[model samples]
Target: MIVQVALATGFVLILIGIYGALTQRNLLRMIVAFTVANSGVNLVIVAVGYLPGRTAPILDATVPAAEAAARIIDPVPQALVLTAIVIGLGVTALMLAFAYKLYEKRRSLDIARFSELKW
Candidate 1:
Protein backbone atom coordinates (compact mmCIF):
# COMPACT_ATOMS: atom_id res chain seq x y z
CA MET A 1 0.00 0.00 0.00
CA ILE A 2 2.53 2.57 1.14
CA VAL A 3 5.13 1.24 -1.24
CA GLN A 4 2.83 1.68 -4.19
CA VAL A 5 2.12 5.24 -3.13
CA ALA A 6 5.84 5.94 -2.86
CA LEU A 7 6.49 4.44 -6.24
CA ALA A 8 3.75 6.56 -7.76
CA THR A 9 5.05 9.66 -6.06
CA GLY A 10 8.55 9.00 -7.33
CA PHE A 11 7.27 8.56 -10.87
CA VAL A 12 5.29 11.77 -10.64
CA LEU A 13 8.31 13.65 -9.39
CA ILE A 14 10.41 12.28 -12.21
CA LEU A 15 7.80 13.40 -14.73
CA ILE A 16 7.62 16.86 -13.21
CA GLY A 17 11.39 17.15 -13.19
CA ILE A 18 11.67 16.10 -16.81
CA TYR A 19 8.96 18.56 -17.78
CA GLY A 20 10.61 21.39 -15.90
CA ALA A 21 14.05 20.60 -17.27
CA LEU A 22 12.74 20.54 -20.81
CA THR A 23 10.66 23.72 -20.54
CA GLN A 24 12.80 25.91 -18.35
CA ARG A 25 15.14 28.37 -20.06
CA ASN A 26 17.27 29.19 -17.05
CA LEU A 27 20.37 27.10 -16.34
CA LEU A 28 19.66 27.05 -12.62
CA ARG A 29 16.13 25.84 -13.10
CA MET A 30 17.28 23.04 -15.36
CA ILE A 31 19.82 21.98 -12.74
CA VAL A 32 17.10 21.99 -10.10
CA ALA A 33 14.88 19.87 -12.30
CA PHE A 34 17.66 17.38 -12.88
CA THR A 35 18.25 17.19 -9.16
CA VAL A 36 14.58 16.55 -8.58
CA ALA A 37 14.66 13.77 -11.14
CA ASN A 38 17.70 12.29 -9.44
CA SER A 39 15.91 12.32 -6.11
CA GLY A 40 12.92 10.60 -7.64
CA VAL A 41 15.13 7.92 -9.05
CA ASN A 42 16.66 7.31 -5.63
CA LEU A 43 13.25 7.21 -3.99
CA VAL A 44 11.94 4.72 -6.52
CA ILE A 45 14.98 2.51 -6.07
CA VAL A 46 14.62 2.51 -2.29
CA ALA A 47 10.90 1.85 -2.49
CA VAL A 48 11.39 -1.05 -4.85
CA GLY A 49 14.03 -2.61 -2.61
CA TYR A 50 11.88 -2.35 0.51
CA LEU A 51 10.13 -5.38 1.88
CA PRO A 52 7.47 -5.46 4.55
CA GLY A 53 8.22 -7.38 7.76
CA ARG A 54 11.82 -7.75 6.78
CA THR A 55 14.96 -6.77 8.60
CA ALA A 56 18.19 -5.33 7.31
CA PRO A 57 20.67 -7.67 5.77
CA ILE A 58 22.62 -8.15 8.94
CA LEU A 59 23.55 -11.38 10.63
CA ASP A 60 22.98 -11.25 14.35
CA ALA A 61 21.70 -13.53 17.06
CA THR A 62 18.11 -12.72 16.18
CA VAL A 63 18.71 -13.53 12.54
CA PRO A 64 20.77 -16.64 12.13
CA ALA A 65 22.75 -17.15 8.95
CA ALA A 66 20.58 -20.12 8.06
CA GLU A 67 17.46 -17.97 7.80
CA ALA A 68 19.13 -14.74 6.76
CA ALA A 69 18.04 -15.07 3.19
CA ALA A 70 14.36 -15.14 4.03
CA ARG A 71 14.53 -12.72 6.94
CA ILE A 72 16.46 -9.88 5.40
CA ILE A 73 15.65 -7.64 2.47
CA ASP A 74 18.01 -7.31 -0.43
CA PRO A 75 20.63 -4.61 0.10
CA VAL A 76 21.81 -4.18 -3.48
CA PRO A 77 19.25 -1.58 -4.45
CA GLN A 78 19.87 0.47 -1.35
CA ALA A 79 23.59 0.36 -1.91
CA LEU A 80 23.15 1.35 -5.52
CA VAL A 81 20.90 4.23 -4.57
CA LEU A 82 23.42 5.48 -2.04
CA THR A 83 26.16 5.43 -4.61
CA ALA A 84 23.91 7.14 -7.12
CA ILE A 85 23.09 9.85 -4.58
CA VAL A 86 26.76 10.61 -3.98
CA ILE A 87 27.48 10.68 -7.69
CA GLY A 88 24.44 12.80 -8.34
CA LEU A 89 25.44 15.32 -5.68
CA GLY A 90 28.88 15.64 -7.21
CA VAL A 91 27.37 16.05 -10.68
CA THR A 92 24.93 18.69 -9.42
CA ALA A 93 27.72 20.59 -7.73
CA LEU A 94 29.80 20.53 -10.88
CA MET A 95 26.82 21.71 -12.88
CA LEU A 96 26.15 24.57 -10.49
CA ALA A 97 29.79 25.58 -10.64
CA PHE A 98 29.67 25.63 -14.41
CA ALA A 99 26.45 27.61 -14.36
CA TYR A 100 28.03 30.13 -12.04
CA LYS A 101 31.03 30.44 -14.31
CA LEU A 102 28.80 30.90 -17.32
CA TYR A 103 26.71 33.49 -15.50
CA GLU A 104 29.85 35.32 -14.49
CA LYS A 105 31.03 35.43 -18.07
CA ARG A 106 27.68 36.40 -19.66
CA ARG A 107 25.85 38.06 -16.73
CA SER A 108 22.86 35.90 -17.61
CA LEU A 109 21.59 32.47 -16.70
CA ASP A 110 19.28 32.12 -19.63
CA ILE A 111 20.15 29.17 -21.87
CA ALA A 112 19.71 31.21 -25.02
CA ARG A 113 22.30 33.74 -23.90
CA PHE A 114 25.04 31.20 -24.54
CA SER A 115 24.85 30.65 -28.27
CA GLU A 116 28.12 28.76 -28.42
CA LEU A 117 26.68 26.07 -26.16
CA LYS A 118 23.99 25.26 -28.69
CA TRP A 119 26.28 23.51 -31.12
Candidate 2:
Protein backbone atom coordinates (compact mmCIF):
# COMPACT_ATOMS: atom_id res chain seq x y z
CA MET A 1 0.00 0.00 0.00
CA ILE A 2 2.72 2.46 0.93
CA VAL A 3 4.76 1.47 -2.08
CA GLN A 4 1.76 2.03 -4.29
CA VAL A 5 1.39 5.53 -2.93
CA ALA A 6 5.05 6.22 -3.48
CA LEU A 7 4.92 5.00 -7.04
CA ALA A 8 1.88 7.15 -7.72
CA THR A 9 3.58 10.17 -6.27
CA GLY A 10 6.65 9.53 -8.33
CA PHE A 11 4.64 9.20 -11.50
CA VAL A 12 2.83 12.44 -10.77
CA LEU A 13 6.09 14.24 -10.16
CA ILE A 14 7.50 12.90 -13.44
CA LEU A 15 4.46 14.14 -15.34
CA ILE A 16 4.64 17.55 -13.73
CA GLY A 17 8.32 17.79 -14.54
CA ILE A 18 7.72 16.84 -18.14
CA TYR A 19 5.00 19.45 -18.42
CA GLY A 20 7.17 22.13 -16.87
CA ALA A 21 10.11 21.30 -19.11
CA LEU A 22 7.96 21.42 -22.20
CA THR A 23 6.20 24.69 -21.42
CA GLN A 24 8.84 26.76 -19.67
CA ARG A 25 10.74 29.34 -21.69
CA ASN A 26 13.58 30.00 -19.27
CA LEU A 27 16.65 27.75 -19.50
CA LEU A 28 16.96 27.65 -15.72
CA ARG A 29 13.35 26.58 -15.36
CA MET A 30 13.89 23.78 -17.88
CA ILE A 31 16.95 22.59 -16.03
CA VAL A 32 15.00 22.57 -12.75
CA ALA A 33 12.22 20.59 -14.37
CA PHE A 34 14.73 18.01 -15.64
CA THR A 35 16.11 17.67 -12.14
CA VAL A 36 12.63 17.05 -10.78
CA ALA A 37 12.07 14.41 -13.41
CA ASN A 38 15.35 12.75 -12.54
CA SER A 39 14.32 12.65 -8.88
CA GLY A 40 11.02 11.03 -9.81
CA VAL A 41 12.86 8.38 -11.80
CA ASN A 42 15.05 7.63 -8.81
CA LEU A 43 12.04 7.36 -6.53
CA VAL A 44 10.34 4.95 -8.88
CA ILE A 45 13.44 2.79 -9.13
CA VAL A 46 13.80 2.58 -5.34
CA ALA A 47 10.11 1.90 -4.86
CA VAL A 48 10.19 -0.89 -7.40
CA GLY A 49 12.97 -2.65 -5.50
CA TYR A 50 11.33 -2.22 -2.08
CA LEU A 51 9.78 -5.14 -0.29
CA PRO A 52 6.98 -4.53 2.17
CA GLY A 53 7.98 -6.97 4.92
CA ARG A 54 11.62 -7.43 4.03
CA THR A 55 14.68 -6.15 5.82
CA ALA A 56 17.88 -4.68 4.46
CA PRO A 57 20.34 -7.03 2.82
CA ILE A 58 22.63 -7.30 5.79
CA LEU A 59 23.76 -10.44 7.56
CA ASP A 60 23.34 -10.91 11.29
CA ALA A 61 23.15 -13.70 13.87
CA THR A 62 19.37 -13.42 13.94
CA VAL A 63 18.93 -14.14 10.22
CA PRO A 64 20.43 -17.39 9.02
CA ALA A 65 22.39 -17.41 5.77
CA ALA A 66 19.91 -19.79 4.17
CA GLU A 67 16.98 -17.38 4.66
CA ALA A 68 18.87 -14.21 3.87
CA ALA A 69 18.09 -14.35 0.18
CA ALA A 70 14.39 -14.69 0.80
CA ARG A 71 14.14 -12.18 3.65
CA ILE A 72 16.10 -9.21 2.37
CA ILE A 73 15.10 -6.65 -0.21
CA ASP A 74 17.06 -6.57 -3.44
CA PRO A 75 20.00 -4.19 -3.22
CA VAL A 76 20.89 -3.85 -6.89
CA PRO A 77 18.14 -1.34 -7.67
CA GLN A 78 18.96 0.69 -4.62
CA ALA A 79 22.61 0.83 -5.59
CA LEU A 80 21.69 1.79 -9.13
CA VAL A 81 19.45 4.56 -7.87
CA LEU A 82 22.26 5.89 -5.71
CA THR A 83 24.59 5.95 -8.67
CA ALA A 84 21.91 7.53 -10.84
CA ILE A 85 21.34 10.26 -8.25
CA VAL A 86 25.00 11.20 -8.27
CA ILE A 87 25.04 11.23 -12.07
CA GLY A 88 21.86 13.29 -12.12
CA LEU A 89 23.40 15.84 -9.80
CA GLY A 90 26.40 16.12 -12.08
CA VAL A 91 24.14 16.50 -15.12
CA THR A 92 22.08 19.15 -13.40
CA ALA A 93 25.19 21.07 -12.50
CA LEU A 94 26.37 20.88 -16.08
CA MET A 95 23.01 22.12 -17.31
CA LEU A 96 23.12 25.00 -14.86
CA ALA A 97 26.58 25.94 -16.10
CA PHE A 98 25.33 25.88 -19.69
CA ALA A 99 22.39 28.04 -18.73
CA TYR A 100 24.73 30.52 -17.11
CA LYS A 101 26.87 30.65 -20.22
CA LEU A 102 23.80 31.14 -22.40
CA TYR A 103 22.58 33.98 -20.22
CA GLU A 104 26.03 35.51 -20.25
CA LYS A 105 26.21 35.42 -24.04
CA ARG A 106 22.65 36.60 -24.74
CA ARG A 107 22.00 38.71 -21.63
CA SER A 108 18.69 36.85 -21.34
CA LEU A 109 17.46 33.62 -19.80
CA ASP A 110 14.60 33.10 -22.16
CA ILE A 111 15.39 30.38 -24.73
CA ALA A 112 13.24 31.86 -27.44
CA ARG A 113 15.39 34.96 -27.71
CA PHE A 114 18.53 32.99 -28.65
CA SER A 115 17.58 31.87 -32.14
CA GLU A 116 20.57 33.53 -33.82
CA LEU A 117 22.82 30.50 -33.29
CA LYS A 118 21.06 28.45 -35.97
CA TRP A 119 23.00 27.05 -38.91
Highest lDDT against the true fold, candidate: 1
lDDT, residue 17, candidate 2: 95
Give the C-alpha miss distance for residue 41 in model 2, angstroms: 0.5
Candidate 2 lDDT trough over 10 residues, lowest sum: 56-65
Question: Per-residue CA lDDT of candidate 2, range 1-119, in tens?
Answer: 98999999999989999999999998988988998998899999999999999988788987778999889998999999989999998998898898888888989998889888866
Query: What lDDT is obtained when candidate 2 is compared to the true structure?
Result: 0.91
Q: Quick one: how many clashes does candidate 1 have? A: 0
Model 1 lDDT tens row, 1-60: 878999999999999999999999999999999999989989999999989889888899
Every candidate's CA RMSD: 1.7, 1.9
For each candidate, the alpha-carbon lDDT, in order, equals 0.94, 0.91
Model 2's C-alpha root-mean-square deviation from the true structure amounts to 1.9
Candidate 1, residue 61: Cα displacement in angstroms equals: 4.4
Model 1 stretches astray by more than 4 angstroms: 117-119
Clashing pairs in 2: none
